[model samples]
Target: MFNKLDLSKELTGRRALVTGGTRGIGAAIAQRLLDAGAKVVVAARTRSDDTPAAATFVAGDVSTSEGVEAVATQALAALGGLDILVNNAGGGRAFLEGSWTIPDKAWHDSFALNLFAAIRLTNAVLPALRASKAAAVVNISSAAATMPFGPFAHYGAAKAALEYYSRTLAMELAPSGIRVNVVSPGVISTPGSDEFARTTPGFSTDDWTRNIPLGRLGATEDIAEVVALLVSGRGKFLTGANYRVDGGMTAR
Candidate 1:
């Protein structure tokens, strides 16, 4: 049955750029794309040795304008061009509840990381995406965008904005043969999730996993497979779609 999925046929000859591809969901997406025969370039603030075969790595922070530009430049040089742009670099810790003590600076910082970073990077790669046969952009969103977990008010708001941005960009770029979409994932078991569990009081992994009807929290691969499909020809007719890969968390 696994062989029958035929995922590989969908991505031959494609070139992709995955931000934050050195770890977690981004790393999983890079591996899936490579398995499907795409040449993948990964960009992140740090480097990792676990990169898939034939993958190129570029170092830069994608949250700032300068960082986004540096990554785009390096990715283009490494991959020769970009056909798929996976905006998987955004993340932050604005989900913790704190009324007056949180400070306004924290809010802005969260948006800079989780929202502006994707916007800036996508903007930098528009021209290249336009030139490819399968021009697609996949923005990694969060279930919190709509679910409204109070702990992460800022994070949720930023993710909501990201969803809006991706849909609007889809409308504007469709005429140019480019597709844009979002993948909103639930709590996945990653190093980041482990860190969050450790820091956030009462937010145990068990607590989060219980919300998933699938009986367990999602893995990075669960999100990555969906992303690969969206950027592939198999997902050609899909755009402006926000898919919630949350193991049924949103269903309830």
Candidate 2:
């Protein structure tokens, strides 16, 4: 069993960078790392009031090549070097009409944010990751990847690609002592999701929760805690694995 109290300094002396770390799930991950005693730098297109105060903030969009380069450069500069990386930035709007209605731009944007960003940022930071004796990378995916739904086809497809990429990356980096893993969250309650719920016609949180074995939506901290464990010494042996923190929703 994992004990939160015992993990206060589990990541002491570690330096971390979390993409999309300004709010929601990304913000929670950054805060968890900071609480675990790691020097954290968060990268996003803009800083918000919710950005963690203790974490250094770098402004850059992960969805573009130029933005990826800028974020990687600035985050490394702020943290000096990186021991951990959490690719926690990803989202997409539901195309209620049908898959046919999802525009080319939507597909392109989805892939850019959910798949390419992680790949590009990792490549950019490969050198720093190689230098760390205990480096770990966690890519945030969505349960939608495996449980495909019509409205979320593009987002799901992109996340599915991310999972495939993460597995390949883990194998390639293993010999170099860099661990790579994926975390897929199910129906997480965040500001983004709340907005999605409000705007999405006929979308009901209660209906969604009924399908969850845990009988509730997941909190950002729920995902963050799992990520913290994966990057800590306790999970040194774990890599190339996908952890579904979805309150057992995927089990069914």
Candidate 3:
């Protein structure tokens, strides 16, 4: 049996689900967990040719009722029951002028995708989570929730809500041996982020690095490492926390 001093196998025999796990930060998180010895299930609306081979793929959208149902059913069946759930399926659509020019549908869609999907998926898996001896739920938020740059205002707003909801989930689920937390990543250099940086007015990849205290853009693995820790036995005492893996972006 492994003990706390053993870093090599903290999550052995665990079963996990990661939404949007086919690409970007989500893919990195899925890979990290697999490395930690967890049985991983990756959920996405579509399959990618580059999707990690170690994970079992469950194609479905997490933003809709039917999609959520599909992912939940598939995950439960595949994993038997889930010991970890990562809500990583949310992102932004570039709409210039943000709050000033964005349409109602954009705001609603943002909430549906970023906030409500987590809520629905979490609710769907609660029973299984309760049954587990040790369980965790990690919701992927953004630095924008606190930093609040306007171009992705709706995304930020939705993520802010998710952070709040995640804390409450922690409080309610703690008694049942389930820990819920939030991971807010800053400007990571993913394909989607690279393009967003290049096109979003004054922002550029170089400029973003200059502003960050780390003097570099973050990699998807940077965020993944933190998530891997949070879902493992090392995080047994942690719950209701919003972890910012932002390279000190918010410290300034």
Candidate 4:
């Protein structure tokens, strides 16, 4: 039923930047965009061969202004211009002491990566995105933004604000033809998520699968596929929306 959507060259000639794209869901997104003929750029603090060999690598952290500036300059220079931006670099260290006793530095780091990084990077790329025929911005949020549990208040609060900011940003950028949206993924199996399964209380992927309506944890490819569609012409009419890729985890 979904086959009518021709994505053979949906992103041809496009320039895309995926932050924290060296691994996990970000890696999958980068690969999909590259396969669709986009000039993809993957950005992170470090480099490894695992990065899509075809995509240009921009090694810069997104958690600080200096890093963001470096990434913005290098990306624009490398790609000449940009059309798709995926603000997918966001994660927080555990509040080992206690959720309420989370350190000030942890809070600052969380906001920097989970919220402000996207803000700063988006502003830096606005001019370039504005010049494109159809620009798209997709922020990778977490299902925790709406359903928080156990020491995630800090991350959840930041992502919640991110969603609100994205909605407002969408309103402001619509006239300029830049679409802003959010993708909230839930329990996707990745190296980063492997620890959660073992550490987080009762967070067994095998058990959760039966509880999740889909009867399985999501794959990185699931998110990659949705993001591919969201940034392509197929989603030309969508903006200011928060899409959940959870397997009915939130429904229950």
Candidate lDDT (C-alpha), each = 0.87, 0.94, 0.90, 0.89
Clash-forming residue pairs, model 3: none
For candidate 1, write residues 130-224 as lDDT tens digits: 88877999999998898866667778888999999999999999999899999999888888888888887878888888888998989999999
- Show the lowest summed lDDT stretch of 10 residues, model 4: 1-10
TM of each candidate vs. truth:
0.94, 0.97, 0.96, 0.94
Q: Candidate 1: where are CA atoms >4 Å away?
A: 1-6
lDDT-superior candidate, 1 or 4: 4
The runs of at least 3 residues in candidate 2 whose Cα sits more than 4 Å from the true structure, single-residue gaps closed, are 1-5
Q: Which residue runs does candidate 3 get wrong by more than 4 Å?
A: 1-6
lDDT of 4 by residue, 1-252 (tens): 357755767789999999988988899999999988899999999976668889899989899999999999999999999999999988875664457888788788899999999999999999999999989999999988998655777898899989999999999998888999899998799887888778877557788688679888999999999999899988999999999999988878
RMSD of each: 2.1, 1.5, 1.7, 1.8
Output the worst ten-in-a-row residue range by lDDT, candidate 3.
1-10
Q: Could you tell me which 10 consecutive residues in candidate 1 have the lowest summed lDDT?
A: 94-103
List runs of model 4 lying over 4 Å from the truth.
Answer: 1-5, 96-98, 199-202
- The order of the candidates by lDDT, greatest first, is 2, 3, 4, 1
Instruction: Give the per-residue lDDT digits (tens) of candidate 3, residues 1-252.
Output: 345365546778899999999999999999888887889999998878657899999988888989999999999999999899999998978676657888899899999999999999999998999888889999999999997667789989999999999999899888888999899998899988898877778779988898799999899999999998898877889999999998899889
The TM-score obtained by model 1 is 0.94
